[model samples]
Target: MRYLWYLLPWQFSPAVLTVCVLTVALYLRGLLMLKRNGAPVGFWRPFVFFLGLAVSYAVLQTYFDFLAQHSFWVHCLQQLILHHLGPALIVLSGPVLVLREGLPRAGRTGAPRVLREMRLDWLRKPLRLAWRTLQHPLIAPLLFVGLIFFWLIPRVHFATMIDTRRYLLMNWSMFADGLLFWWVILAPKEEQGSAAVGYKVRLLILPFISMTQIVIGAYISLVPWQLYPIYALCGRALAISPMLDQQIGGLLTWIPGAMMSLVGVIVVLRHMMREEEAQLRMSPLRAETPGSSRPSAEVA
Candidate 1:
């Protein structure tokens, strides 16, 4: 009974717990400041903090369960959640303005020395040259669909076939890439630019991207298949029961990930619309005032 602390994976890694606690504490402190001092909870702060907490919980839970016994399906579930859902949330959580004020002044510095030395011109050339090529309307949908199949590859799914460490790294890297790629099209204008297409246009595009996962999952679920054979022995040895586990994993990936991502797109679009409306309302008042745009209530 005294050793109950062992039940928590966060206890095993003080660093992970430390980061999670600090992040939540910062958000809570910001919330208190907003309540008391009329501070704004910057656009992305709430979402970023939410993402951090969710990822931390998912990672810790997976780590501890793995330590208890290596179940192939459990590992797959963890990877899918960490890479597919978690990192996407993390990226969407970005451009946090509330957290901006909380950060020390040092972090606000622009263009580090390392960045200055990096030859960005060469890298930026192709992106500029073939902006249209890079802007293929199908790229985002393909990435989302490709991710569904890529993970199911027997080599990737099988833990023993590849180095577990490398697999984890690849999963995280791919997740990050997916987030960045989609963001190029779906990203909010407040953080980037107000393009020819408005937030409403982006809202329409989001459904197409989100549905890719659902279609892939439904196909896999209905088909007769064994996508990850290497895991068969491991699952049997570790009592994972692959068929049942795979079905659940597919459902988990298909349902929550797509739904959450669509929700994020909707939230961002709403935020953009609200900001635009506020600006429009303020514009007329600013124009009417001839002198400085400050409120005039001077009685001495």
Candidate 2:
């Protein structure tokens, strides 16, 4: 009976709950559109894919993050899902076809109208703004490096540990920033209005970015010194040795997180290459004129 509380499923933060509910609602709306006679069938697959991802996220949060005992590896896994994988998957699963069809029959007239307008001007204003911002070239490299530096800073890391708001804010912000940075570089040219870089370029750039973390982790791992005093306090509170705790946290930050980043870069680079090749193939063919006989030849 004493361990009954631990047996209860994990609880989600309000933000997670809201997102989950919205995802489910959107999925249902898509289904409703399918049933309606006038609605288009374009949105079903994308809606289903996104809905599935949302449900997977919910399960991870409820079963792994909320219910399981606090372990560094578990925390790393959660971060991989909520931060690295989730944002990219959701963005890639944009509701272009589905939203177009579903929103019309969603029974929400205002939203439908707005979405229609957005569909007309989507890339022009909102998405264009985001695209330009993310592709600055400066933003991605800086963010890639800055996140590690900020994480290593004693005050910043400790602040995150002490304040739930700070922890959530820092992690979520970095994750969003990372996704946005990559999105600009990897998004389809039609949507982005500018060709994404070649896959070869991305392969180089992505590895270069990931290497920063490998270096940071190596440095932290080699240093015998304790960078954060809070680790000692946390160790005492949690009844784990301070050195072991710090090492575990460092490993979580270093290995799995870095691997996730590297993997994303690889995938995005591959997509960029395929997009470039497709564009090359689809480009208008140049008209070739056969050599014209000299007019002088007729006179001769």
Query: Judged by lDDT, which candidate is best?
Result: 2
lDDT of 1 at 241: 63
Candidate 1 lDDT score relative to the true structure:
0.54
Provide C-alpha RMSD values for all models, in order: 8.1, 9.0
In the predicted model 1, the residue pairs found to clash are 42-98
Clashing residue pair totals per candidate (backbone < 3 A): 1, 1
Model 1 regions lying over 4 Å from their true place: 1-57, 60-76, 88-95, 98-107, 112-114, 117-141, 159-162, 178-187, 193-201, 236-240, 282-300
lDDT of 1 by residue, 83-180 (tens): 45555555466534545444445433432423345645455546544543433445544655576566666676564334656554544555555555
Residue pairs clashing, model 2: 43-98
Ten consecutive residues with minimal summed lDDT in candidate 2?
Answer: 291-300
lDDT of 2 by residue, 97-209 (tens): 44444554444454335557657645456755656656655566666667757756777777776676876676566666755655654554344335244345555666666
In candidate 2, stretches whose alpha carbon ends up further than 4 angstroms from where it belongs are 1-12, 31-77, 92-131, 194-201, 229-232, 235-240, 276-300
Error at 75, model 1, angstroms: 4.3
Scored by TM-score, the top model is: 2
